[model samples]
Target: MPSSQTRPTPAPLLKPGETVVLFDGVCKLCNGWARFLIRHDHQRRVRLAAVQSPEGQALLAWAGLPVDQFDTMAVIRDRQYWERSDAFFEVIGQLSARWQPLRLLRIVPRRLRDWAYDRIALNRYRLFGKYDTCLLPNPDHEQRFLKITMPFVAKSEN
Candidate 1:
């Protein structure tokens, strides 16, 4: 059996109105997506957390999701949890115009969309080079991430 230590720690209690996005920290593609969101989200409405983080684990448990199945992106919006393609679309909907157009993907059936997402997720490590560790956020974006056991932010030049 996988040790409980391998499982993520429970997340901290979040205030209402916080939308947390949990992702695979070591996945290069996932890290890129987080940076993309941070860049496009001019309003700074979204908060990011890694699936391996305590806060992320807590949120996954609260949402009744299996922590081991976090290979793909997960979005917690309005207190509701979304995974795979559904999570992707919902996140785009919250972004600015260029990203909002992605919301049209909702027209695709959930099963079909998630099937495609799963395929990419399965091959992500092979297709997109993974990191030895998660990407640390730059200082300017530090406020965007919730601190976890590992340092998730890089030092600022300032």
Candidate 2:
């Protein structure tokens, strides 16, 4: 339950066995993906972070990713980093039936698969639009979200 506000930003470096997903929090499609994972991730196997958040930036830097490129999803798994299609596939592999079918696309050549992924990512905002701000987690699932003060967590009456 570490809050981004209180923790000093660590110099960017990858951590072993930790799976951190960095995403564009304000993107409607991205938020929907996170929510879907939250509901289906029965074991709570992944950690979430908004690409715009401090912790997200730290992670990106540590993983040696470009700060300006937050358009694609990034997954840091087993101390190794994956971006674009690889990251998306890795995520789906960990989720339930809701996303499991995406794993089948892995059989396609990496370049082609990534090309499709990039097209969708590039047009995500145009197709799905975006939130004025990051989506807040549902109270019951708040514990699954990475806490960042700037976006302001929505209070859950529960």
Candidate 3:
């Protein structure tokens, strides 16, 4: 199998037709963002997974991102994976007309946009506190979360 460092496409991670939002499970801010997505996404266009979960780990492996270091939000749509502010814009832009305007942030240089995103991400736990456990989706929304068998673990040498 390809290693997590290889940068995989998003399509294979989804079912026949679906998208996913992979987020930091312990971060309150990220949970808030996921809640925003759940509320605003009327069409149920995307599913959510916590980066600490097995499903999230699998997707991270497929995307070639380290499962141990989830410093950015990830949105997987239309067979592509977007990270950081790009992921933020892409998810919101597709939600509704009201959110479309947020896409304008894309005009900013990626390096600049990501730098700001990184700062907030780095301090999110300090600013917002953390959940002792991953946030649980509402009972009605449980199906929208992806489930996995187990996380992929690399071999270690003694």
Highest TM-score model number:
3
On a 0 to 100 scale, what is the lDDT of residue 136 in model 1? 78
Model 1 lDDT, full chain set? 0.76
What candidate 2 gets wrong by more than 4 Å, as runs, is 1-16, 96-101, 147-158
Error of 1 at 65 (Å): 2.0
TM-score of each: 0.80, 0.77, 0.83
Q: Tell me which of candidates 1 and 2 scores higher on TM-score.
A: 1
lDDT of 1 at 24: 90
Model 1, 1-158: lDDT tens digits are: 10011223333455555667898988889999899889989998788998887778877787777887767777775446677887787677678887766677777887888899999998998999788986778899988987545656988997
* Lowest lDDT 10-residue stretch of candidate 2: 1-10
Q: Is 1 or 3 the stronger prediction by lDDT?
A: 3
Instruction: In model 2, state the lDDT of residue 150.
Output: 65
lDDT, model 3: 0.80
Instruction: Order candidates by TM-score, high to low.
Output: 3, 1, 2
Q: Residue by residue across 25-97, what tens digits does model 2's lDDT show?
A: 8999999888877877887778788888877887777777777677788876554667888887777767767
Query: What is the number of residue pairs that collide in model 1?
Result: 2
Rank by lDDT, descending?
3, 1, 2
Point to the candidate with the largest lDDT: 3
lDDT per model, in order?
0.76, 0.74, 0.80
lDDT of 3 by residue, 18-125 (tens): 779999998999999888888899988889999999889988777778889979988765456788887887677669798888777778888898899999998999
